[model samples]
Target: GPGCVLGLFTNRFFVLRGYDMKTYDRLNRILILLVILSFVMAIPAFAQTPSSDPDEKAYEEAKQDAMGICPPIFLRDENGNTINPVSRVNADVPYSPKQTCGKCHDYDKITQGYHFNQGKGEKMTKNFAQTYPWCTSPGQYGGRW
Candidate 1:
């Protein structure tokens, strides 16, 4: 009797330690639950949702499919005005994040002595965030380029 009981319980012990019949059924339920959880976790990758953010997703989808992508970020043009030219994102170059044109002016605070004067059709202007009537456009945001 002892040998039979030990043999019968040995596999159950190894597979689902300390579980009685009812508890073993519950343990099996949990194993199934874990498998289901893993299955659900894999769904998002296949969904093929937009890129990093909604705007980015919109930009890529609209690049040619719907409305065109918003014109590329502007840099200075022939007459010193910010002009948006058609340029593809350079995959070969390193990526840098730039939100506003003024963000390009790296040495403004240090180069106060050489403030660039506009000598062309477009006048150069800058905005300090603290100033009132502040504009969020490229030049208005302290854009350097």
Candidate 2:
């Protein structure tokens, strides 16, 4: 019922029925003790260091490797061809972005992305321009026409 009175103590809420002062006081103390016991049980979990988690350690190592802080592995194609991103089709050899990078990864979706659409006629949103006007400014390195 909307008329029920709620008793709050130590971040917990409990309903008080029948205006029994003794029962309410007893329930309040029980709830407080339960909260304290829960916190005590969680102490060992909180004390555990970040290095104790193998997943976290692995993620940190991967991040370092990706950021070039750690050595990078040379990737090769299925046919033992050294994967070189710089290789491009020469004159009279017709090549597209999809034809190039698509051999190893999906380049079609990447080409349609915002970063690759730099010189394209895609209009920058007003919010984007307001947030990062340098991207649209003429003198900046990433400036669009």
Candidate 3:
């Protein structure tokens, strides 16, 4: 009945009926304790494994579909939105070039490749600069022999 007060404790709701003040107080305390215990015992859910969980599996498949190139291992947040998505699984240095990546690629590739070969000289292609893996603005170079 709607008038019946049921308490959800220990993962189940029990009707607190026919109990005196002392008994009701004891039950209330027990209920509070059980809730606290359950909360304390709870572990931080990590979306389980991509195999064991159906949702994660679906997300993994969706990600694989969304990403045509090599897929990087990223994490799904609590809201089920993907966050901190990285690029590929191997070394990111080649893609995120700091001082290297040019060691093997060289100036010819950098200057003549899709990034700088448009005859813009100092001006860069906005699209290329934004999409190109590693971005280096001109006049930002200080390399010398």
Candidate 4:
């Protein structure tokens, strides 16, 4: 009974055993023709140039405007004093990057990022604490090597 039902459904849909060799060959050719047509229709979309879009052109221009070589900068120490390499008073003092770059950039905000902070104030999980006894936090600073 099950096999008869399956045979009826297959014959009705021409899915398995109902089609003659000629019908199957024609259906295969039509499927191949449709696939080729779809690829042909997609050719123009793939061939479009990036500069053809006004939005993309504007984005490229803006990106180019933002990226450039840095100009010469005066290095400053922790106390905001300019460090002259040859100056006797500043000869042995190390230049502080925070004071120098912080003049134009937000040092605090930049350092607050995950990469710079390295889990300094993050919570320590019980499993992590048990695994790395020396680590005080879940990240690189106090956690795994």
User: Top model by TM-score, which number?
Assistant: 4
TM-score-based ranking:
4, 1, 2, 3
Candidate order by lDDT, decreasing, is 4, 2, 3, 1
Give Cα-based local distance difference scores for all models: 0.47, 0.57, 0.48, 0.70
Model 2: lowest-lDDT 10 consecutive positions: 2-11
lDDT of candidate 1 over 45-118, digit per residue (tens) = 88886567889877767776643534445454333444343464332342232323345545455334333322
Error of 1 at 32 (Å): 0.4
Write the residue-wise lDDT of candidate 2 on 28-144 in tens digits.
677777888999999999987778789999999889887785344434453434555566323333334344456656767776676666546556678877877667532222444
Cα error, residue 35 of model 3, in Å, equals: 1.1
Q: What C-alpha lDDT, on a 0 to 100 scale, does residue 25 get in candidate 4? A: 52
CA shift at 43, candidate 3, in angstroms? 3.0
Q: Estimate each model's TM-score.
A: 0.29, 0.27, 0.22, 0.34
Which regions of candidate 4 deviate over 4 angstroms? 1-67, 86-89, 119-145
Query: What TM-score does structure 2 among the candidates reach?
Result: 0.27
Error of 1 at 136 (Å): 28
* Candidate number that wins on TM-score, 1 or 3: 1
The model with the greatest lDDT is: 4
Pairwise lDDT winner, candidates 1 and 3: 3
Tens digit of lDDT per residue, candidate 3, span 14-83? 3344445555556667777777877767744543444878998899888888787544443433333334
